[model samples]
Target: METHDSLLARIAPAPGQCSRTILDPATGTPVGEAPVHTVEDLEAAVAAAAAAQPAWAALGHDARSAALLKAADAVERSAEELARLLSREQGKPLNGPNARFEVGACAAWLRATATTPLDPETVVDDGETRAELHYRPIGVVGAIGPWNWPMMITTWQIAPALRMGNTVVVKPSEYTPLSVLALTAVINEELPEGLLTVISGGPDVGEALASHPAIGKVMFTGSTATGKAIIRSSADTVKRLTLELGGNDAGIVLPDADPKAIAQDLFWGAFINTGQTCAALKRLYVHDSLYDAVCEELAAVAAAMPMGNGLDENNVLGPLQNQQQYDILARLVDAARDAGARILLGGNPDPGQPGNFYPTTLVADIDNNNPLVTEEQFGPALPIIRYTTIDQAIAMANALDVGLGASVWSPDVSAAREVAARLQAGTVWINKHGAVDPRIPFGGAKQSGYGLEFGTEGLKALGQPQIINGWTATQTRATPN
Candidate 1:
């Protein structure tokens, strides 16, 4: 098998002293050379997509659905190799929770999107007059995906866009571009050339894709700051956008909840993907009656989970995917400690550690005002805040600039759902957290970002709405300028 480095070098720009090396976060070893693309590269890709989208869309829904399903099959066939590459590049453990699952999710999403129907609806019918609403493809879609869950999130953007008949030009994160490139190769076998192009680079490439005049829609999944930048860049073109940005999600533990039963679920909810998830539970607000018990239970679970390199089968949690995130998390933990929050578990990074590994940390008695609780610490550290009343907990949770996801934990399903309805988030869970489905729409509210990502609403977001109206000969028609 050709090495990842060699595979990437074939498509990369001419070898230069300035070429950026993609480091394997697990070992800090150079795994691939990411292409440094210019505005020309982005323009060429967008132009190709602009030319290809009409024919692809003209093939109609059935043909497009068949191609997507075939692409899904190709992805499944190469799942193992892709999963291995993903673990090496993204620092997600291959066997345990999410690395393999992420790769498999790409295939699953493609299949689901391939079959999700988008039939024309008869909006009005009054015997003599009738009207129908149609969903038509919106030219080329520019997809800028994040590094965490690289392949799955990329598919989350492209699959629906393609299913809705829009050709795509994707720019994956430079840190983990190879897996997306590899997955694109598999997909291209079933898709038409230029229908799904992968261009890898830093901000320059992303900026070009977002602002390109040929691109009709931009689908982005990243930090709120970057999402805002894309919105501004695309503003001149008045491009359609579907932005899935950051989230500092809060998970509340009601006084009636059982800490022991919910401990394992809560721990994984916050720490999945090594707590590098944008929608992971960053803050936990527990009722004072159950706060201490919840803290101890959560601490015990965190202590038991193994954290190490992604290749190790025994390790469920891997290192932070990059140094920047590691530093941010470390600073947040330090601030929490200085603010008088009690550290119930791991709080420091091991200087001797080979990778960017911050231990699974739990800080208790922190207030909502603490930076650790307020900011989206996309790492392994979680702050546990104490709340005296349910209203206080809900208020504290909703105080942040972000409102992506929130959850309520209680034994009474009815009571839990009542509180869930009050939480200001795109998706509120009764017991679980961050369990999103393709059949349901998922997007952020407020500064978190806008536009849904899945389901009928999301599918339609990628297309333009066209309405056809007809009247009987009995109705008089007037010509208007």
Candidate 2:
């Protein structure tokens, strides 16, 4: 029953604590004040989670799953309030696959994680020997989330961790802490105290969390640089790490694809969340036969999508979440322009604009090695590169060090799948891009990240594995004889 203001007030910083005011990215106005917890606060939270984990784990899988189901219901009950807060704090629109979609995804992931079965597996069952593999809770898990898709990604980390019987301490990004705090507040209503906590702190707190001896695992989703830092910090403790790092995902359109038919999906795949997603298509490779037609159709789609204040229901696309991101996008686009890339739809923005509103830009006829193509421009701008053959497209897609996700678009599913297999990424789609399902396992390859997330494999990643090996009844009987 909480309204948007009531929800913000509920998670507001307590009196006398250091706090920072989060601003609406669309208007640069105040959204809410988030508590700035320190390293000491993070240590205390980890300690509390370690203390509370034993009893929570002892409740058994069924009991823990039932609790998660309740938490999912709690999320659904306050969906609207949470969506509004997320929209304002993250600068994603209220409709589309933005605010409301993110909130819904949270609830769906919770339910999926709660219900996905992960029973102990019998690895060996001969007459002379029997062995079963089981997963036990990893005392306390540290979840470091990104500003983009804050609530949904937070749930992606915590739901499976909690379901696997681990208590979680979350550290949201400095840019969007209010959304995470508000989300945790709603889920905590159905759980025991200290089982989950959010430490809205800076890098020092994150470093402490990664290195803290009490934490058994850390789930991080952010840039490659930060992921590498976490790896170094956790080396001493050897903490289990699941890192979904930066991705410059590429999409390949075969010669046979109907440009107009696939235009809308391609546009959203890149521009969703204003192109801030880690797995969104950043650079595209189109066969030379279809390049011009595809570019025209994509430009038409991007031009029609409204970009403005998130609060306005009519606007499906909003501003960049922060000034830093806007500046990065502007610089990359300018560089592309100077390099003689064709600006198909938009490449210009008014400097006088109040918010960080970079126009939905599509740079065509760009070189494969341009900064806009090679770098991760995590904004609403995509570069289209032309390829003469399938081998060239595959080579271009696999050239990057980071391979989180990729896609191959064609009318022939068989042909697309063949090309998809050649791409170097954790997951690849045929004719669609960035359509992640909770039931499927998602992760990164090479420098993108090491661990897998989602589905049963994801649940297993959050826990410790043990093999229960012993003699079978036949062996005991023979020994007695």
Candidate 3:
């Protein structure tokens, strides 16, 4: 089959056609284009992954480890080029922590999954009989990733699948297809054919991939609405699934917290990646004692932030991925202000800036009933609500349906730990925010979606348990007697 030249690829295809374009969010230019795969393309990719899985699974741990290590090397070598493309495609900070952190996640996850063995062991060892357990690879895995974390999240899905000896078919978000392809290209150079594959396109392709009969499992990271849709579509086949969905992660600023520290943590937690992160901080509940100080500190930082194209080295804030988000963010801010919330610092679009970039907007006095409080604003806006008591603060924080992640701001370690225990979330940080570990599981509870990614949990997510009957020669002799 002939492949189209990358330069001539179309962004969006005509109705049924499989084509797409990559928008440079910085200047509103066509950065690049790639094929928008169709339902048929989804079928083909699924078929390819299904057919390739058995052989890949048979390779055992050592061979797979070598491939993963090679892929890690490739990623490290291409980090610069990948970061540039990611920054342009995703409109993130030019060579800053976000891009570098993503690349580091890829390297870390791949190497860790490959090197760490998901060893199956013997369960019972009686004198008469023994039972041993073994893990077999689940068949083809369908991975649907999100735009907020196109590259790193995909690696979380793909690396573990490969490590567990499974083949993968990835469906990346349309907005940031280039980074996924770039990552895939690196893997293709290191791994064998069909071990990993990528299909980029729109919603139909995603539905097709989700419903494909050959796909044994699906690991999805997107919104709760779409995760529900995926669950419904795959109900007929009963495909094994792991969904890491939406989040309205709240941060609790205790009476004992420092204002300046809370302000800086709040800035990065909410404003990082222009607030296009699922786990980004959206809600803040502050104790009345420190509420005024926290508000002032957050506004002081927000006022100092410089918004510009991600390509600019000096830029700290970049564009929101699309126009709908731009409008929604602005509207949310306005609604919060209209609903009696105090506008501490930011509340509008920066008229002088190019692209869909918005300033780091901060609002205060928002209540749980407000839409800004309930919904996930995937932008650089943080709503701070004051609470008179710790009980009131916890109550307000738990009001949202999403329980993806939460952070507690307190100078007291014991208090932070106590709060972290009761908070309804998959992961919670104490006195620190957005801290993640590769060796630990990362995911959410409630409407945030079920299942985990990374570490031993990720490997377990891709395996099937089996009992092997065994008996030593002496045990067999004794049983005969």
lDDT of 2 by residue, 1-481 (tens): 7898999899988999999999998898999899999999998898899999999999988999999999999999999999999999999999999999999999999999999999999999877888999999999999999999999999999999999999999999999999999999999999999999999999999999999999999999999999999999999999999999999999999999999999999999999999999999999999999899999999999999999999899999999999999999999999999999999978889888888899999999999999999999999999999999999999999998999999999999999999988889999988888999989999998899989999999999998999999996557544553
- Best candidate, lDDT-wise? 2
- Tens digits of per-residue lDDT, candidate 1, 174-229, equal 77888888889878989988899988767888998889888899999999999989
lDDT of 3 by residue, 1-481 (tens): 1121231232233465555667877778876666677777778877888888888889898998889999999888877667667777888876445676788778888898888767778688877678888878999999999887688989989998888889999999988887888788877789888778888878998998888888889999988999999999999999999999999998898888899977777788877777888888888888888888888988898888787777688877778878788888888888888889887776767677778877777888777778787878889888887889888878878877789999998879899889888899999987666667768899898999998887887788888778888777775344553
Pairs of residues clashing in candidate 1: none
Q: Show pairs that collide, candidate 3.
A: 10-20, 11-20, 11-21, 18-36, 19-36, 319-357
Which should have the higher lDDT, number 1 or number 2?
A: 2
Evaluate model 3: give its TM-score. 0.93
| Cα lDDT for residue 100, candidate 3 | 67
Off by over 4 Å in 1: 1-18, 478-481
Look at candidate 1 and tell me the lDDT of residue 41: 74
> Residue-pair clashes per candidate, as listed?
0, 0, 6
The C-alpha RMSD in Å for every predicted model, in order, reads 1.9, 1.7, 3.5
- Tell me the spans in candidate 3 whose CA falls farther than 4 Å from its real position: 1-18, 469-481
Prediction 2 TM-score vs. true: 0.98
